[model samples]
Target: MANQLSGLDQIFSALADPTRRAIVMRLCAGEASVGELADPFEMALPSFMKHIHVLETSGLVQSEKSGRVRTCRLSPDALVGAEDWFQQQRATWEARLDRFEAYVMKLKKEKEGAAAKRPSRASKRKGAK
Candidate 1:
């Protein structure tokens, strides 16, 4: 469990950067060489490489070198942990909100019931008069 949490931490930390996120997004389509991946950015190769390094370290991406070219591809499985965590959180919150809504409805109905059991001011005035 600790290992899973650690991995999720790394994945979220890596994705915190817009550049790294963009790189992962691009790789979602297909694998591309390092040069091709860096083409859309204005940063230098070394700077872009840092982003790639973070993604690689997070296991969100994998790269291989052949000859002079280095190709990078997204590791879809790496995202599963984060996705599962998010889904769990969504379910929890939805359940909590549902309970809260039910509680509010219960209170509203109880208030109505209490009001219905009480005599109205107009009826009391009519009796007095």
Candidate 2:
């Protein structure tokens, strides 16, 4: 569990950068050579490669060298645990919000019922006069 959380931390950290995210998005269609992947950005190769390194370390990407070219591909399965964690959190929050809404509705109904049992202030004033 600790290891899984650590991986999640790394994945999230890698995704925190826009350049890394764009690289991941591009890889979604298929694998690409490092040069092709780095083409869209204006940064130096070393700087760009740092982003790639982060993604690789996070396990969200896999790269292999063929001849002189390093081709990278997305590792879709790496995100499964993170996605599950998000879904579980969404479910838990939705349930809590539903309960809160129900409680508010119940309070509203009770307030209306109590008001129905009580006389209006105008009527009380008239009776007193």
Candidate 3:
């Protein structure tokens, strides 16, 4: 569990930078060479390479060199752990809410039952007379 948290932290950290996030978003469309990926950014190649390095280190992107050209592709499964965590949290929250709803309904029923059992005090006094 600790390791999973650490992995998620790393993933979040990698995505924290705008440049790195942009790279990931672009890769979603399709694979592209390093040059192609770098073209849109005004920053220097070395700085852009650092963003690529973060994505790679975080397991978000995979890169390979074919001869002189390096290509990058998105690894969709890299976010699986994060997805699983969110799903589990949602499920837990939903279950708790369902239970609370049930309890509220039960309380309402009990209150109605109590109200039904209670007679008017004036009717009781007239009966006593």
Candidate 4:
């Protein structure tokens, strides 16, 4: 559970910034260098680099220095935490729905059983015979 919480912390922290979220979305296309990642943004290199740094620290991106260029790649496992969280939410919803279904079925059966025990209008009228 601690690991899950930490993973959620990282996911939320990394996503808190719009710039970092945009970077993550862009990185979905493939790996990219810092310059390539920063090209679309109007911010300075230092500001943009901060976003990259956050992403790297969050384990959302992997970067390595090769000569003068630092290339960054998306880490697929970083999303596992978020996916697990979503799965847990889905399971809870499904269980709630299943419970609701059972309740409704029980109500339906009770209604039918009650009706079965009561005399119909036609049967009551036939008592004139």
- What is the overall TM-score of model 1 with all chains considered together? 0.90
**Of candidates 4 and 3, the better by TM-score:** 4
Pick by lDDT: which candidate is best?
A: 1
Name the candidate, 2 or 3, with the larger TM-score value.
Answer: 2
Which 10 residues in a row give candidate 2 its minimum summed lDDT?
A: 43-52
What are the lDDT scores of the predictions, listed in order?
A: 0.97, 0.96, 0.93, 0.91
Predicted model with the maximum TM-score: 2
Off by over 4 Å in 2: 125-129
Alpha-carbon TM-score of each model against the true structure: 0.90, 0.91, 0.71, 0.74
Which ten residues in a row are the worst by lDDT in model 3?
115-124
Listed per model in order, the count of residue pairs whose N, CA or C atoms clash below 3 Å is 0, 0, 0, 0
C-alpha positional error of residue 121 in candidate 1 after TM-score superposition, expressed in Å: 4.7
Give every collision pair in model 2.
Answer: none
* Candidate 3 Cα outliers beyond 4 Å, as residue runs: 99-129
Clashing pairs in 4: none
Ordering by TM-score: 2, 1, 4, 3
Candidate 4: C-alpha lDDT? 0.91
Candidate 2, 44-111: lDDT as tens digits: 99998899999999999999999999999999999998998899999999999999999999999999
Give the backbone clash total of model 4.
0
